[model samples]
Target: MAELPLSGLLVLDFSQFLAGPSCALRLADLGADVVKVERPQGGDLCRQLYVADLALDGDSALFHTINRNKRSVAADLKDPADLEAVKRLVARADVMIHNFRPGVMERLGLGFDAVAALNPRLVYGAVSGYGDEGPWRDKPGQDLLVQSLSGFVWLSGNADQGPTPAGVSVTDILTGAHLAQGILAALVRRGVTGRGGRVDVSLMESALDMQFEQLTTFLNTDRAQPRRSAVAHANVHIAAPYGVYQTADGYLALAMTPVDRLAELLDCAALEPFRDRSTWFIERDAIKAVIADHLMTRPTADWLAVLEAAGVWAAEVMTWPRLVEHDAFKALDVTQLIESAGGGTLLTTRCPIRIDGRILTSPRGAPRLGADTAAMLEEPMLDGNARVGE
Candidate 1:
């Protein structure tokens, strides 16, 4: 087997919930030994932060999904002894990550400055809701709040509809990805400079970054707000034919196809007047209305076949069941069944990245709280001179 990129590295995950733990999970996938440090009382709050009241082995299924392949050590920062032990672990860690609001880590004496002092070569990563400063810094960095505050909610849904946040925790997931990217970059720099650096990411920043293309256009175009289409629009900035239209049986998503070509294929005479490509955006709703009514006359498969045969980009919009059951999804091999320490199995998606043409996978699931405390505490310090936990 090829060696994983992050082999031999140790990551101390001092984060709770999604953003921080997800980052640590990726590092663990790449072969880093990730140790999740949690509060002694209940460990990470996510253990009980149930998503739809579903859990495995007494921990939320969501927690297991994000925290797979990690060991846990219960520690109370308020307790001087436990704090000292965590500091020692930090001193030995190659990477340390946290998503606490500003001032919390500093209050616990585990801020970047203090941790960096203990381990000069440590790559310290921090994720905040807004940023370390500004009026929103102290506010809770939850996903939905960040999405609403960052104008992300306005980007989805129809023009007449109320603001719609994404179905998933997009801000948290994107923030985690950004945090992982920054940590990787810092690690590369450390290899060259022999010095570690601090990586800072925020949910607001990540949410904005996800809208770079649309935001760029919005920013440069006289500060115009996104105008979602009246029809089944997928993106606010995209022109007509860039949406899902309901067919006789299901839905068919159309991409950037020529309106004339669609008119020829679908036999919709109304779309013929939309020959001018520039008018596609200006008269999107009218063109989409014609397309929508025409598509509803036929089933999704018939539309897809005709559109695909004509060299037009289109596909049948699929639900989770259809997607998972399809041969295409099976060929991708993106799903994995991970087993917890208690032997409970979880069906979850695996990492999308491939290293040396191999999909990354690990059988281990999320650890039980404090499961590795004694073992990790017995390991020698970074200098290999003594056991710091003693």
Candidate 2:
């Protein structure tokens, strides 16, 4: 079959942090030629995110997930010579990606306007903390800050307790995803017009976009923020019998959305109270309490098996180890064994979608710091006229 969509595209990635590198990674996965440009001394900060004090001998897990299928070139952009070389690289590139603050690249004389002038076909991709320019533009915008600003962090944790931040770097991931989308769209437009355009993505914007429903609700209503639905937050709510129930075996979430199904699955006397949608809140609270009491009587596994068999969606709330080991996980190809430090294998979550039934990209290890610097930065100094060698 033909190579993945971006085969002939050349992406010069001047990004180290999550958002920028992730977009390059996505392009790499699609078979684009992605060359990561990093500083000579430490390279991308991400390489040290998980395991501090990292070296080429030990790439961090956080780095590997977003940097695979990319080649690295170490160059000190502050040096005039190296900066010129990057311009040369951009002149020949189909895409240039960066996550530096608004004017950083411009100060280095490597901004989109200059590079685009050099190569009309170059697609410039930029990711910012707040935006290129705004009241909050100069403020440091990390994933944590974006999460807190976007209301994502506010909804997390239980309703009663202070909101807990998501364990993962969701804002970075969301921004990266948006950057990839913008790049793809720009590529399509460039194909039609024979001129590439700038693709801008902001973490603040992406995070807010992600909270679409909540934002929309607040926009139209008087509520300042979305009230967390009690039934949805607690896997087991006192008012809804459909939430997860406990058993002597294990915990399994109850799939009792429909009133009839809830009644039948829970073996309750009736669900007339549920039919009155106006009071789902009141009814859900009471019903959840009853379900909780009933579930406490059995083992989790027993409850899960009974509920699942009865067509109520249910699964054991699995731990990381148990989840990967579960037969269902194996059947679904949701995990892959990747080579970690010491040549030992570590289980990593596979990408959510499968292409042609393939779960993970064929085990290309993360590039060591500036591993390709020698080959990349070496002078291949033929002028454009002579380089073509027609």
Top lDDT prediction, candidate number? 1
In the range 18-136, model 2's lDDT, one tens digit per residue, is 88988887777676778889988889888777744443346677777677657788889999888877787788889999989889999888888888789999999999999977799
The runs of at least 3 residues in candidate 1 whose Cα sits more than 4 Å from the true structure, single-residue gaps closed, are 378-390
Q: How many residue pairs clash in each candidate?
A: 0, 22
Q: When superposed on Cα atoms, how far off is each prediction in RMSD?
A: 3.6, 4.9
- Using TM-score as the measure, which candidate wins? 1
> So what's the TM-score on candidate 1?
0.96
TM-score of 2: 0.87
lDDT of 1: 0.88
lDDT of 2 at 361: 56
